[model samples]
Target chain A: MKIKGKTWKFGSNVNTDDIIPARYLNTIDEKELAKHCMESLDINFSKNVKRGDIIVADENFGCGSSREHAPIAIKGCGVSAVVAKSFARIFLRNSINIGLPLIEIEQTDKIKNGDEIEIDFENGILTNLSNNQSFHFSKYPEFLQNIIKNGGLMKWTAKKYIK
Target chain B: MTITEKILANHCGQKEVVPGQFIEADVDLVLANDITGPIAIEEFEKIGAKKIFSPEKIVLVPDHFTPCKDIKSAELVKILRNFARKYGVRFYEIGKVGIEHALLPEEGLTLPGQLIIGADSHTCTYGAIGAFSTGVGSTDAAAAMISGKVWLKIPSTIRFIYYGKLNKYVGGKDLILWTIGKIGVDGALYKSMEFTGETIKTLPMDDRFTMCNMAIEAGAKNGIIEPDEITFSYFKNTLNNNIQNLKSDSDAKYEKTIEIDVSKIQPQVSAPHLPSNAKDVGEYKNVKIDQVVIGSCTNGRLSDLKKAAEILKGKKVNSQVRCIIIPATQKIYKQAVDEGLFDIFLESGCVIGPPTCGPCLGGHMGVLGKGETAISTTNRNFIGRMGDTKSFVYLANPEVAAASAIKGEICHPEEIK
Candidate 1:
């Protein structure tokens, strides 16, 4: 699987609160959460984020709070993928469980906001469409790959237990 | 194996488990708060789970957005109320509810050597009692609720030893803040933090809970202190059966070991936007504060309230400061009232709120306005954590928070005179 999108750059330690503040956590509706996604960093984020856009960040892209709303809001806001120098542990688990693709780039200095990039999920390659530079990340384990492909843990567990 | 490894292996029925191994582990307890409970319940239904795996093993505490911040939060809580009723899970209603992390151990629902999972990050707070508890997302929580098992990654262990005696005013909150300042926020990412040494050996259970609660602040999967006589004594009144003494083997492998000297340390206060941005309290004495919040999963226990009351026993809260104190549970609140701590708080111009996680996550009850600054005992001082984005939060222990409230600025406890 491959994804291509324009990048929205963020700095290190973009916490769960910044991704989606606690005030908006009253509802389980993904769209309601999406409407306020990343508003702390950019007030107009959800309004301006185009469909299939990607997010790139420095390090520890999702830190603070174990609320899965952070990833759900990101996904709901029309983000195709996220590339970061590193991901927080809980955030990584939540994103995979929610079927959101995350990539790790050692140094994100070269990736600029509004720069277009393409990701090859199977091959673990991220190509900067603007500069044509390619970087490689470690591929997910087979089990995790299947879980994400099956569209998160709920459906995956349902396939095995719901029958 | 380390303590964390031993607990995980035992739960998964594995003879041995190493770092980076994925195993399906059984949970002794599963926890969720109102905010995450609704989402987990929704996913639980989507997966068509008929009955809960173990009704007795599940815990629901509606503390986060509790006391009904608004109609939206009330609706969200109704979902948790319904789910708990349907499953017969242990649910703490509004009056009976405390912070989930504090309430569980207080009620002896979480014990040593158990593998517990929760949908809230602070669930790692249970590690103080030697349990292997960690936080997961809502979907994972829903799955665990159905099967009483979930996937776990055996993380490497980072051992921290604090040898020196703590200063009079310094406590677990100070020690943990100093440790986080020494090691950046992500230093322990995906690692288990094993706290040991003479300082921890005699530390009270409340302070131990305070330290373990902030393990996630340093990005640790869990923070634990091996169960000893102190731990056993805390449980002596609650359980008839003896808790086994659990500790890491001498030959256990650790990712790294750090030694901290609390004797030489002073009270610390973390600055805005990051818990790692810590500084000695004296540096910020000139920075006046608007409010002081003295409760949460981190430091809302009896000892914390007593300490806050001790400093504010006779002195009044500053005219410029609004001090809000909350006991973590109804039992604690009643104890405080019985002990006259409530009179001390009331006479000092402080208002006591119900046992809710109010204002900690900017939920409500004492939300800060623009340009306001507060010294809070609750964890997390991220931008806009306690209020508007322009508001600032300084993280400190309850004593420091109380003194700051009396002085209307960031002042050390000793400076109150």
Candidate 2:
């Protein structure tokens, strides 16, 4: 699977609260959540973000709450994928379970905000279109990769257990 | 193997399990709150499962936005209530419900050697009871509800051993904040923080719960303490006689070991944005506070209320500060009222409320305004955690919060007197 998108960069330790504030936690509607994604950190986020945009950030992305709303909001906003130096454990699992792809790379300084990048999940390579440079990331374990391939844990579980 | 590993292996039906190895383990209890429950129930329905694996083992508490903050939140709770009624799941309603973390253990839902999962991050609080409990996402929780099982990767264990005795005003909140300060927020990512030592044994169950409750702030999968006599006594009346005490093996492997002397520690606080950004309370004495909240899953127990009441028995809160006290559970609220803690709070210009998570997650009740500053006993002082992004939150124990309320600034308990 390959994902191509423009980047929306964030700094380190961007917590879930920053991704989707608690005030908007009143509903489980993905559209409502998407409208407020990153609203607190960057008010222009929802208004400006386009479909197939990618969020790139430094370490500890999605820290703090275990609310899956953070990932739901990100995916609902039509963001294709998220690339960060690291992730809070629950957010990582939440994203995977929801079928939102997440990539972890060591050096993200070269990728600036608004840079067009393409990620090759099959090959574990991230290419920055603006710089014409490529970086490699470690592949997810075979089982997790399979789950991602199936779109999410829900789909995978339904296939494995329901029928 | 360590205690965490032992419990995981037992639940996974394996002879042994190593760190970083993913295994499917049978869940003893699954927890979900109002904010996460609706989504989890949706996911569970999508799986086309007729009924939950075991209705009795599923616990749902609507504490985050309880009393229905708005129409949207009310609608969300309505969905959860319908699902609970349809499936006969154990659901705690308002007034009876408290913070999920505090209510679960107090009701004996958490026990030693049990494998537990919750949709809320603070689910690690159950580890204080010697249970192998961790937080998971809503989808994971939904899967667990349907199958009574979820997949998890065994985490490496980090051993934290404390010695000596805690000084006045220093408590579990300080210890955890200090630990997080020493190790950055992500220092223990995907790791089990196995807390041990003579100091921990002497600490009350409330303190133990407080310590384990904030483990997530340090990026730990769980924070656990081996069941000792204190633990046994706490559960004696609640648990069955067949309860087993689990402990780490003498030769248990640990990725790292940290030792701290409680005698030398000071009352600490975590500044805004990150829990790892901690400092001694004395260092921030001049930081004036606009509000002081002494409740939440972190420090909303009876013992915490007693500590705060003791500090505010005669004095009143500073005119500039608004103090709010919320008990974690209804039982705790009754106990505080019976013990005259409520009177003390009222006399000290504090507002006492029901057993709701109110304001902890900035849900409702007492959210801060723009540029406002609050000193709270709740965990996580992340940006806009309790209100506006311009507002600041200082995380501390109940004692520090109560004292700060009287002075309208961050200070030690002794400073108030």
Candidate 3:
């Protein structure tokens, strides 16, 4: 359970509305939503973001709106993971339910934009490839880890509740 | 235990629940709107669930882009309509539907001591009636639709007690803005805000709804007031005889307690970009405005309109400002018409819109352009919330919004005379 990618940085209180504006919320198509991912904050995000890239941000990322579109857009745009100082409650749950891995690290400022980083989900270790620095984040609880391991709540619930 | 804990524990079939403990609670009511309903239904189908756990328990409202702003939105609404019809789910059509939060309580769908979940964050609005209602995302809503249950981490309680009488221009909106300013946006993150005190008890049900509606602006799980006579009377004809009077226990523990003197408080305004960036209205007396919007689940009730009408009657809006008024629900819209508030608005040069969530989320009806400024009665003054990213929004009570429209700048209601 490890992920490696270049990082894109955002400031604190990055609201969901900026992640995906309300106008584009009419459709549930992940690809369509991905086209506008982070367009408000960075117009070139969807165009330049590569698969397995990472997004690192300051505190209270994904703050406004309960729209799951924010995480869906981020995940659909081929970002592997999002590491932030903290997340709004609903955003954290939505990301987990949708199988988008989110890590909370206190020293997010240490990771600069475009820095190559690797995250070890099992060991809670974050290695900055460019700088050779290491940081640690708390591991998820057992149940939450299982949900992530199962790839999302939908798959987890399907396996557990359905025959 | 606090009232929120009591409700969650009751639904979870537990003797007691503590903060930070994950619990799966039975949902008595579930809600989704047009914007989130299509996505939730798609996820619900992906789970391979044949039918909803309970058709009657689920409520769908298409208020966000109602009347179908575009072909895509129309198609989205069609998806919801077809699903609702096939599954026998309760659906409120355009004319019947308003803001989901306001419609639920007005229709008596939300009850005290009930655990309710919605796809929209403002769903916390129902906590005004003592219901343990909170917001979740589309996938969470989809899971709830299938299983009739959702997982929630028990949140600690933060109690706020208000005393003394409110000033003439001050109301629930001012109180909430003041609170949000005192506590930063994340001050109550993942915590239940239980409001109590003489001022709250005497406040009208509409004001209570206004107060609870903005709890999410402070990142609160829910904002609630114990059911009082005003709340009971609002539900008197609809509620059953066995209604519960849920309240916090005398020995209940709280993470924090805040006491506010209502009499000493002034009409507050949350400035641009953050609801927590609040200031006394006197501080921004001459901040010019380009638009004035008075509606949304927050501050769009009949009382809000009446206040605005009182300020706008026999007066016209300034030539430089665009004033838009939207009633929260159809019932409120009809009542405003019956009370001649619509005439006052039209004569005052305000554009009266149907019951919809127009322009509040920058969706439609009165979106601001670049470099514009608006004084809005709705909550959440986040950057680009009303329109362009460069546009500015100042949040205030309905009275201040109306007065600003007339003056084309931020002004207190008392200054209108």
lDDT for predicted candidate 2 compared with the true structure: 0.91
Ten residues in sequence with the least summed lDDT for candidate 2 chain A? A154-163
Give i-RMS (Å) per prediction: 1.1, 1.0, 1.2
CAPRI quality of model 3? medium
* DockQ of all candidate complexes: 0.77, 0.80, 0.71
User: Which docking band does candidate 1 fall into?
Assistant: medium
Name the top DockQ candidate.
Answer: 2
Q: What is candidate 3's CA lDDT for residue A95?
A: 95
Colliding residue pairs in candidate 3 = none
Q: Model 2 off-target regions past 4 Å?
A: B237-245
lDDT (Cα, tens digit) per residue for candidate 1, span A1-163: 8999999999998999999999888888999999999988999999999999999998888889989999999999999989999888899999998888889889688899999999998788999999999999888877787787788888877776565
Alpha-carbon error at B30 in model 3, in Å? 0.7
- Estimated TM-score per prediction? 0.98, 0.98, 0.98
Candidate 2 fnat reads: 0.78
